[model samples]
Target chain A: MMHHHLILRVVTKMLVGTIILFAFYVQFHGDFSPGGGFQAGVIMAVAFILYGIVFGLNKAEEVFPPWLVHKLAAFGVLVYAGTGVVSLLLGYNFLDYNAFNPGHPSHGQHWGIFAVELGVGITVTGVMVAIYYAFAGRPPPINDEDW
Target chain B: MVETIINIILFTMLVLTALAIVRIDSLFAAVMLSGVFSLLSALLFVTLDAVDVAFTEAAVGAGISTVLMLMTIALTSRTQKKATRSGMVPFVVVAVTGGALFYGTLDMPNLGDPNAPAQLHVAPEYLAGSIKDIDVPNVVTSVLASYRGYDTLGETAVVFTAGIGVLLLLSGLGRRRRKDEEGDA
Candidate 1:
């Protein structure tokens, strides 16, 4: 159904890769700069969302299925909580990174922050994309000419 | 001096955009204007040295929010209807609330005041401890991930819950309804 816009399709094809690279950069480089999980995850979701807008919802869903998105969202929360659970099992207070490295608290802190941020980034990405899919998938009741 | 000029220019444009959003009758135009407003706000946040917040505002507020709003408009009407009721009461209420908000700002410390209560409390500790504990240069990340670990866990849960709720409301119901229609057909 997406027709008549040759320019948008070409441009999006070129830009999507760059956008994804930038999202990863923001995700990992956040410790040194002004970005983190929330920002990075949203950026990551934007890549897929832009692709869906330029192409079509079906193609986007083929690349990233709804069931997978739901699993990733649930799994992300589990990763976050599982980290705390691991810490508790190691005979430390929940989420105390000192448990990760008994000798070096700072190193433990680094590992903990990384894991936690990864979980956050994953959950945010999944949730945002899932929400996008849910809204976009609704059958359009109005005529296309009405737009 | 240049910063002040930028601030004044941005604020003036921001107010103009808001006024235009209010006056615009076409819902599509209003949605685009709101995206512009968010981008302007993100820029303002950047100028205020809040780059992290600016990034979020730009991505989520301008980017995702604009897409979602456009999709919502697609499923609904494109034009706003003229108000049938008197606007005088709502106008007075809005004016009073706006005036009160402006009045409240007078008692607050100026931006970046070193002696402000916020500056004196755990913020300084966070700034200092981030380097000592997390060994991270970006204090915001360390603070969010380390000091406020439980709080972030809570935030992630909230995001998860919200996503599930939306998926249930939109796709879950819509899918079943569509199946029923197909069966009937």
Candidate 2:
């Protein structure tokens, strides 16, 4: 039953890489484009979730273990909060980007935005994947034929 | 002219999809129709020149949420149970709430109105200052990450809290598996 759909498995294999690449593009190119951390993060999570759906949950879990997913989720929040704390330590207002590069405030803003967006991306990806795992891990009460 | 046509088509599709979802007895069909609804709304967002929102709606709404709903259906029943009670009271409540909401929209500014309160506020400064201060071409990103960093931070925290809550609730499965193994040993 697991390997029943050859087309789905093969197609997912081809699509996964492209999805991840697009997610990265959306993440880094966000400053110049319509996407940002949130959209990018969702796209990234979709890749993993797609993999899980096609290849079965066990294989996907092997790729990204639950423990790691939980850690990554918390770590993203820490990274975001840490950036603000750093600015505070530097005697600037909370989340003041000017503190990152004092001579060129715009450069500092760029760096600060990049870092915080990265944090947002990471957290969102982790949270989404974790939630998917939570839902998919439970055994369905009904059989496949019922649907 | 083209934009108006596109908007009308998309909105019509959205209304039809919503009606189909309401009329459908099959849970799976409803889920699929909701995904269609999301895709239509994403197209609407694109026509409105909010590509980021469109991208998010397409990905999260059409993609992830559909998958989540399907998973939920797997866990539960595929067909919705027939309502034993009449839906009149609920219908009246919905109509009243929707009417009030529609009434509220009368006070809202027309689309793309320059004199709108939203456009008259700090948005102009953000648009003007973003390139000079943040040096980002995407003013939305600059505004979200720099100008309103705290608000985004709060949003992130909210996502974090929700994830943790779901994990706490559903994480019992792993413990149960471990206990089963111990019992076997």
Candidate 3:
């Protein structure tokens, strides 16, 4: 097999950085731009996958530890679900924006929406990263003699 | 006119990339092509003005899924050295099923029609009332989180399921053995 080149390494790093920044841009600018939580998560996942392909699976795993990714993914869902539960506890229906804040319905809604979107972003990004590590880390098959 | 042209180009690229995914013998190349398919689909979503769906597709389809696939490929097989021969019956069945699905889609609304029934329904209410109803600038977010929060919750659950599935699928006896060794040391 051909060894990975330095240029490929630099390009991969650049691409990864670019993807992350773009994800953030997409996440925050969802109100105006053509992106939101899903786009950002996918972008980050792609970046990591690129990193794995160009650098090495071990290095990619090192950068994004699997345990941490699992936690983040779980946390993302918690955040989203928690938002609804919070609204429900506040005396409104599940995910009722009016209940987010007692008096300021619109403000509460805004905050709630932002929080949920952030949750979506977190969960998706983590799950994707975890998947990448799992797949890329598969051991090469053993030979018949080794078996 | 320019937007329409760009959409056409993106659609073409998406088709080409998808075809490449099938044709490429190398598993890695196939995975990469799949990512390109996701990227192009994201572009198509943007063109169709379904930003929220586009965002989700970008993250799940292109980002996390691609990496996971690569990891799976690594664990299972690196290269497609041997071209396995398959019977034609299965291929014919799959082709016929796919063709029927394709034909079914023909009756759907034209892509990105602002005045379609879909646009006229709950979407219009969200677009118009979001400012007054939820007071959010982005109707998409408002609809997703506030009006239709159940759907968003379900989506999150799906993400959680996927994470759990990955952990379960990839973890095995050797992995546990390593953990045990580390713990003992």
Per-residue accuracy of model 2 over A21-61 as CA lDDT, tens digit each = 99999999999998888898899999999999889899999
Q: Which residue ranges in model 2 land beyond 4 Å of their true spot?
A: B173-185
lDDT for B125 in candidate 2 is 98
Best by DockQ: 2
Candidate order by TM-score, highest to lowest? Answer: 2, 1, 3
Q: Can you tell me which runs of candidate 3 are displaced by over 4 Å? A: A1-5, A8-22, A44-65, A140-147, B1-16, B51-64, B78-87, B112-116, B173-185
DockQ of the two-chain complex in candidate 3: 0.52
The best candidate in terms of lDDT? 2
By TM-score, who's the top model here? 2
Clashing pairs in 1: none
- Winner of 2 and 3 under DockQ: 2
Write down the C-alpha DockQ for each prediction: 0.83, 0.85, 0.52
Give every collision pair in model 2: none
Q: Write the per-residue lDDT of candidate 3 for residues A1-147, one digit (tens) a residue.
A: 115477887777777888789888987777665566767776766777787777777777788877788799999999988888888888888877678676877888778877888898899888877766665555656332321
Q: Once model 3 is optimally superposed onto the true structure by TM-score, how far is the C-alpha of residue A70 displaced, in angstroms?
A: 2.0
Higher-ranked by DockQ: 1 or 3: 1
Model 3, B1-185: lDDT tens digits are 98989988998898888788777788878998898899899888878777677767766677666766665665576567664677588889989999999999998888777888888888877888888867767777677777887898898899779777866887564688999999999
Instruction: Residues B22-100, candidate 1: write the lDDT tens digits.
Output: 9999999999999999999999999989899999999989999998998998887789999999999999999999999
